[model samples]
Target: MRYYFVLTIFSCVFAYEKDLTFSVQAGKTDCFYHKVLPNEVIDLEYQVIDATHGELDISFQLADPVGRIIVADYKKSENAHRHTAALNGDYRFCFDNTFSTFSQKTVFFDLMIDTEENQDKEYDEDKEMEFGANSAESYMMRMRDISESVSRVRDNVSTARRLQELHSAHEARDRNRAEEMCAKVMTWSMVQIVLMMTVGATQVFFLKSLFEDRGSSSYKKLIPGLGSQ
Candidate 1:
């Protein structure tokens, strides 16, 4: 039992998660590479957040060590995929933004690789043995199950919270954009009003000057005629 406990601790320590967040510009592509041994199992999951365009879909592909494309997806917002490494070399995955012209995107991804030989089998066997050992063992098994259930619930809650945050961010971005447009429209309207007022005032002043000039010329002609008589 002591040996098993130590082994489990080591296994948990070795099993780690890799996280990455990156931005891709319009009409560009980003790639990530990872090296793995033969027969290794890989777990991958990703999400796109805060895109200039709504819906936030992007293209992606996974290539093997020898440059063979293994998995590919197009216009996906979120995804989870699993793959088993067949060759002992570097593997690559890429996010593509070829279809977008002006919108940039932010992406978050995670990778988990199983490195131990027959790790799943060993763990399952250990769990079975421990469950059948004694009364205390059975109680421990039940507690472990409960713990696992709680962990799953926690993961669900975390995912929900992430989604909520992303949605809120999207809403705020849209609101800001709308406010900017409103400001521009109001400024243009004010400029137009000012221009119209200036043009109208100029026309009125010119007409009044023309009428005064005509009346003065008539008076001068009449005065000359009266002096000659």
Candidate 2:
């Protein structure tokens, strides 16, 4: 009985979840498709993390099996969408960078498919088998209470994982921006330093030239009496 309980918990904990990171080159479109069954729930979240030209925006679209657009966004930095499958077929989603001529976009996305009904049905069937030998009413009630608690914990874990992934992606995007800004500032500072050094050197040379005579003949050209001395 204990072994069966552990197995059930493991099954519930390991649900269907996929996380991916990819790059979409400039003036190109990348697409993916997943097969889903009717009544299954699909959750999608995506963020543009980094870009070559510092433009953190991309076009996104989700289409149903019949070529109907169910969710669409234009030049968005980050967005999420949730939908329930109505038909059994391949659903397509795409990331478009066609609007960018020279920038490549790096994107992070999460996809989750939830079949709560089927999970519940399987749990119920297992519960009946586990309790069939022992018909005590109070015992069955107690087991059901435990099952509910476990289900709640499973849901909380899933939510927490999703939130953690989103936070990580946000941190990465911010870090990239900070690094780019730092590089620009450093480059400008170096250029200013070089210009200041060059100007100072020119001023010093000019001041020295005023006090030193190049030759007696040259000095005599400026002062009429210098050649006689």
Among these predictions, the greatest lDDT belongs to 2
For 167-198, candidate 2 gives per-residue lDDT tens digits of 99999999999998999999999999999999
- Lowest summed lDDT over 10 consecutive residues: which window, candidate 1? 8-17
Clashing pairs in model 2, backbone N/Cα/C closer than 3 A: none
Off by over 4 Å in 1: 1-21, 34-58, 64-66, 70-91, 98-122, 129-137, 172-176, 179-229
Residue 138 displacement (Å), model 2: 3.9
lDDT of 1 by residue, 118-190 (tens): 5545656777777677557765565556545554565576557656655665565466568767888999999
| Candidate 2 error regions (>4 Å) | 1-14, 122-139, 214-229
Q: Best TM-score goes to which candidate?
A: 2
